[model samples]
Target chain A: MKKLINDVDAILGESLAGFARAHGDLVSLSQAPLFVRRRAVTPAGQVALISGGGSGHEPLHAGFVGRGMLHAACPGQVFTSPTPDQMLAAAEAVDSGAGVLFIVKNYEGDVMNFEMAAEMAPCATARVLTNDDVAVENSSYTTGRRGVAGTVVVEKMLGAAAETGMDLATLQALGERVNGATRSMGCALTSCTVPAAGGPTFEIGEAEMEMGVGIHGEPGRRRVALASASAIVEEMMGAILADLGAAKGEDVLLLVNGFGATPLMELYLVYDEAARRVEAAGLTVARSLVGNWCTSLDMAGCSLTVTRLDAETTGLWDAPVHTPALRWGC
Target chain B: MSNTLVLRLIEGMAGTIESHADQLTRLDQAIGDGDHGINMARGFKELAAQKAAIAALPLGEALKKAGMTLVMKVGGASGPLYGTLFIDMGKATPEAAPTLADLSVMLDAGIRGVKARGKAEVGMKTMLDVLCPVADTLRSLVDQNETDGLDERIIAAAGHALHRTTDMVAKRGRASFLGERSKGHLDPGACSSALLIGAVVGVLAPSSAR
Candidate 1:
């Protein structure tokens, strides 16, 4: 409640206006709580990518909107899924004709809401790829992975794939592959406030941190008094890598993501530990990204994701060109 | 059976949740990150603020308003689940806010909505585990002359079903992933449902005195 705003209800619209003001060259806000590619999308031969979720994970689903990334991004409220109307608008605004693909996180609300919207939206052909790489505790059987930090990487690679002129079907298949090959694990030292909730989403003792925590402040599988950055990274890496089953000699892409409110220095320190653990396990850490690539509001914590690399995937990983959030090989 | 009584039940339920938000949040903080209390509290506060309109409005509209409010305002599992619950009740309120029979059918629809939304069923350590059973119990109580001890029956049933939560393994909710560790803890969802229903029953209790 201590934040600056003209009206609490119009905050989303006002903030979006501010973003459009700053990033006018790259993107602009649409009528809906959506951000579309400033460039016209030609869907005839090109595969258009779209992804959306709640708004709090900033510089996310939206910031990645650009030439090489998502053609449209629909943002719901903080940690809430967009309604069908929003998604329908995004699909239409971005669809140039060839086809559109939706990269959705595996949370139930996101999946259900997206499914509803897709059912209503008319497009060439759309594929929905759900990301659930939590690596927390197994769900019923093998369906247990919860989508976490891996979404940022999957979007990057798939964005690059689309940039390379991969057809919708091809991009869809590649997205599915990336979704399968990734896993993420998170730990939290404190809970984040959901802005509207007006307070910390949850609380943790100063001496303790929860392990296996999900983004929504849902309980993690385990908790213990806070430990060293090295130990925390080791445990997170251990959980993620164990679930991944990547062999010691295998090469992998690693991302150490800050939940939010964590500073760059702290992230680099954690990354230092994570990189060491990856090498110590005899696996080749081919490439590593350390930053607030994905977050859970201003929650003080971090998560780690690993993407098993193959020649094809590594190429896409390298192919990412430009986005407000991630920019590299152009 | 009266619409007057039914409206009172909802108001009482909403009040109960408003009162117990802190306890609920504290419980959630244990197995999951907290927020149940704050979310539900905010949800009910919205309901209370529009108390006159909500009580006077057709049951479905009121419930739908409640559900939509939660959907927009609350986040995480509780919002969706409670929102779904109210949505279902609203959808069931074809004629007016639910009467006794309508309440029964409304709750069953709510169960279905939650099951569909959460992909979670009765065994999940969610509110449905309690709400579903209580709905069933209430249906059976509609007949029979008692009406006097009905509150006790509702409370007893909710309490009894809640205790069973200890034995069943959680299949959904955050704790469901914990597998066995979830066994000992009373499902927070179930406990909250009991509190809400207990409030409804309590408000109706003094009615017999009146």
Candidate 2:
């Protein structure tokens, strides 16, 4: 219940105002606070990349808005999906005539609203859905696999592809290819507290951990007695690699994502174990991201994502990207 | 039956929902993300803000305006679901005074709209659990040519349906993630749906007494 805030009601507005102020050079907030887009105008023939969902997952759709990344992100309230109107507005604002590409998560609300928006938008729009969580299928908020940290992979690959002058269909195919190659699994040491709820979502005993937890704290496999850090990482990574059908000599991009409250030291430990485990499996770790790129408020946990990469995807991953949370070769 | 009466009825419904916001939020916190109350309150507040303009329109137009406002202002699953109900009801309604049969048709349209938008069916532990029963009762009464205490009958049907949802497991929305854990808690959407029907009764009972 106790945290830094002016008021519960002002959370979205104030947070966005702060975000816009901090990254004015790279991004601009629309008047509605529904979306944030790149500050500069998009080229007339370039495909626009747009992605969004609920607001609790910080540094996601919004923070990824910058050069060589998303052109717009439509954020809803905490754990809620943005309405179609927001998407329509963002599509109008950022579309440069080539077309708009929507990178959506598989949550029911997100899918419903985005589907409605696509029908309402003025410009031609194509969509790519991220359903990379290897944990539970048909969980509380979605019909298929929950989209987790692999969304960052989808956004990055498609963002780079769009910037490279790829047409809408080509970018969508690339996005699907990356998503098909990616798998992620998450585990939580403790539940997160949603601000509006004013309490932790669930209580875990000191000796228990929630394996395969969804990003929104939806129930996972089952609560089991906590294990050593290395042991947990191995099990999570094993699930992902098995699901992804990864094999020896395969090159992969690794992502060790914090579920908000996890420390860098722990994430690095997770990364060490994850990278070592995959290497032990004879897979080469070519690119890695270890941080809170996708979060669930202040939950205490982390997830592992492995994307089996082709040469083209690796090149796109290495492309220049400048955003508030990420910067490379700008 | 007047357009002014319809406007007052909508205003009354907004007031009822606003008063119960905290109760709905509490119910949601037990099994789902706890923002149903805040989202619904914000949406109704938006409708209240434009009350003067809504009142100036005919009944069907006013309802449509209210529905659009909720869709724009409320950012969640409930927003689109509830907004679709009102919008569909408006589409089925006539601009002038409507009879009991006409009300039944409007309710049927609204309930169907919710079903299409949410892709939820009966027994899914959603607002449909409350609204479908009420709409069915109204339709049956109209078909049987029974008009006595029709408003009270619809209200009772909605109340019964709302209470029944606590015994069922959620098969849709955030609470569905809880699986069996979602049982024993009242569905927040169902509760709000009952309140909407109660709001209608509030407007009709007093007018009938006069």
Candidate 3:
């Protein structure tokens, strides 16, 4: 209940405004709180990449908006899906005659709203659904695996592919390739509080942890007695790797993502162990991203996303990118 | 239902959702992410804002506009689901004032819309648990020529169905995440739908009508 904010009602708007002010050089907020896009729209021939979900997963759909990433991001309230209108508006603003690609996470509301938007939008629109979380399939709020940190990977790969002047169909196909190759699993030390709700979404005992946790505090596979950080990472990696089936000597993209409240100190600890395990499994870690790329608002946990990489995907991951969160070879 | 009756029912439903906002949030907190009440209140507030504009319109157009308003403003699972209800009902409704049989057809269309949008059926601990039964009761009453106290019967059936959600397992939405843990808590969507049906019955079935 005690965090930095002026009021509960203004949290999303004020925070977005502050983000716009701080990163005005990189991106601009729309007249409404629904979306944020690059300060300058994408180049004329590049396909537009749009992704969105409920707010609270910061630096996600928004921070990724820039030269080689997302063209636009539609954010909803904390953990609530954005309306179709917002997605439509974002689509209209960013579609550059190359058609638009919606990189939707596989939540029921997110899917439904995005689908509605796609149907209503006048331009040619296609969707690439990311459902890389290896947690319980068909868990609450979705028909299949939930989209977790794999979204960050999908966005980056597709964003780079778009910047390469790929057509909407090609970008959409590349997006599906990345999503299909990725798998993520998370474990939570504590639950998160949605600002409007004024309390934690769920309760966990002091000596217990949630396994295979979804970002929105959805029930994981099971709860067990708390264990050491290394032990937890091993278990999480085991689940992800078992599902991934990466071949020996394969190059892969790895993401050690924080679920909002988890700090870098622990994320590094996770990355250290994750890198070692990937290497131990005879797979080469081609590229790595470590930070809170996707989150669930003040929840204490981290998720591990592993994408078995092909030569094209690996090269795209290294593509020059200029965004607030991920800026490098630009 | 007459256009005036439809307008009055919408107003009453808005008022009821506003008043019970906190209760809905509390119910959601137990199993879901705890924003059902907030989203519903925001959506109904928008619907209420359209009262003057929709009051004079035909029933189908007015209800359709109401659905669009909720879809644009609510921005959550409930927005599209409830919006589908009104929109489908509007499409199914005749241009003229609807008789009880016509209302039954409208409700049938609305419930089907919910099923299509949410992919949920009755006994899945969703709004359909209450809405489907009400639709059935309306059709049965019409078939039997038992129109006396029809609104009362609809409300009572809806209430009973709403209560039944407490014993059922959630198979949709955020509550479904809880699995067995979702049991014993009343589904918030069902609660809101029941309140909406009750408000309509309150307007359409005064004691004199009974």
Candidate 4:
């Protein structure tokens, strides 16, 4: 309720405008049907990578929209999915002669809106649905596992491949493979408030934490008393490792992503714990990323994602890339 | 129905949604992301603003335009789902006045569109829970040649359907993430859908009918 904003209705536009201005060198904003496209034109034959979701997750789809990442990102209202018009327009704006690929999280709203845009897109388009959260039970009776922080991993690897002029189909296939190999789980110490809602999405006791929390502050698997950081990481890593089933000695990429309010100090501490767990399991932690790359508004939490990597994927992970939130070997 | 009647129905639905926005948010807070009320109120407010323009069009066109407005402005699972409902219903409606049978067909189409858009079914603890029952009630009424107290019957059916959602577990949307925790709460989408249906029918019926 006590957010620093002029008006609730203008929060998204004003923040987007500021972001566009601050990062004008890397991105440009379109007003009518809102979307952020890379400042530089997409290569003549390179596939365009577009991904988006609700707005509260800072520097996610938008901050990732630069060189060697997403070509464009369509942002919706806080915790709300973007409409189809935004996606379609973004596709038309960025799509080169090559087709477009949509990196969609497996939320109902995100999936439905992106599906509508894909159907209405003028050019060939495909989607990579990320459902890497291992907390939820995947079944025909449910919507399957919710896509959490692993989306960044999928986007980064696919962006690298697309930058190398991979065709749309190849990029889509690579994205699916990366997503399949990834698993994530999160725990929240506190709930974040959506601007429009004017209060926390869910209330938690002072000493309680929601295990397996989604990015949007949805209730997780269960709420339990707070425990030590190492204990939390043990349980989270256990779920992720059990789901991934990576072989011993396999090189794995570990991403300890902050859910907005958690600082880098704590994130690094989490990364340390997570990496130790992975190593203890007899897996090699070849690549590691720790930051607030994918966040839920201001929720105090973090998610750990483990991706089983091969030589090809490891090479892609090290590829040159420059974006607002991520930069390496540029 | 005439354009004026359609406009009245829009106003009624918008008014009802705005008034109950807080309740919807409360319901969602229990099992979902707690934005349903805010999202629904914003969409209907926009729809109300365009009532004059939308009312100028024929019934089918007006419904389609209204649906598109909701889709563009709502920006959540509810937006596309509700938008599909109205859009498909509009597609099934004739330009001229639709009879009871035609209305039944329109409702059925709208329900089908919602199902396809959300990949959901009647028992998924979504708007479909309320909408499907209302559609069946309308169909049965048409088949039985019952016209008296039609609005009351439809409203009662929707109310019952909405209440039924309280015990159901969510299998779709953000609420599904809660698993068994999602039970014992009314689905916000179903609550809003029932409210709109009741509002629209309330406007069409005379006071004596109630």
Per-residue accuracy of model 4 over B102-154 as CA lDDT, tens digit each: 99999999989999999899898999999999999999999999988788899
What is the CAPRI rating of model 1's predicted complex? incorrect
Identify the runs in model 2 with alpha carbons over 4 angstroms from their true place. A139-142, B207-210
Ranked candidates (lDDT, high to low):
4, 3, 2, 1
**What's the DockQ of model 4?**
0.72
The DockQ leader among the candidates is 4
Q: DockQ, in order, for the candidates?
A: 0.16, 0.41, 0.52, 0.72
Candidate 4 error regions (>4 Å): A1-3, B208-210
**What tens-digit string does per-residue lDDT give for candidate 3 at A1-330?**
988999998999999999889999999898564699898866788789999999999888899999899999998988889998888889888888999999999887898788778878988999999999888764343367788999999999899899889998988888998999999999999998888778877789999999999998888899999999889989999888999988899999889999988889999989999999999999999889899989889999999999999889988999999998889897
Q: Candidate 3 chain A: worst 10 consecutive residues by lDDT?
A: A136-145
Candidate 4: clashing pairs of residues: none
Per-residue lDDT of model 4, residues A82-168, tens digit only: 999999999999999798999998888899889878877998999999999998889998888888888999988999999999998
CA lDDT of A35 in candidate 3?
90
Candidate with better TM-score, 2 vs 4: 4
The stretch of ten residues in a row with the least summed lDDT in candidate 1 chain A is A135-144
Best by lDDT: 4
TM-score of every candidate: 0.75, 0.94, 0.96, 0.95
**1 versus 3: better lDDT goes to:** 3
Ranking by TM-score: 3, 4, 2, 1
TM-score of candidate 3 to 2 decimals: 0.96
Per-model lDDT: 0.75, 0.87, 0.88, 0.91
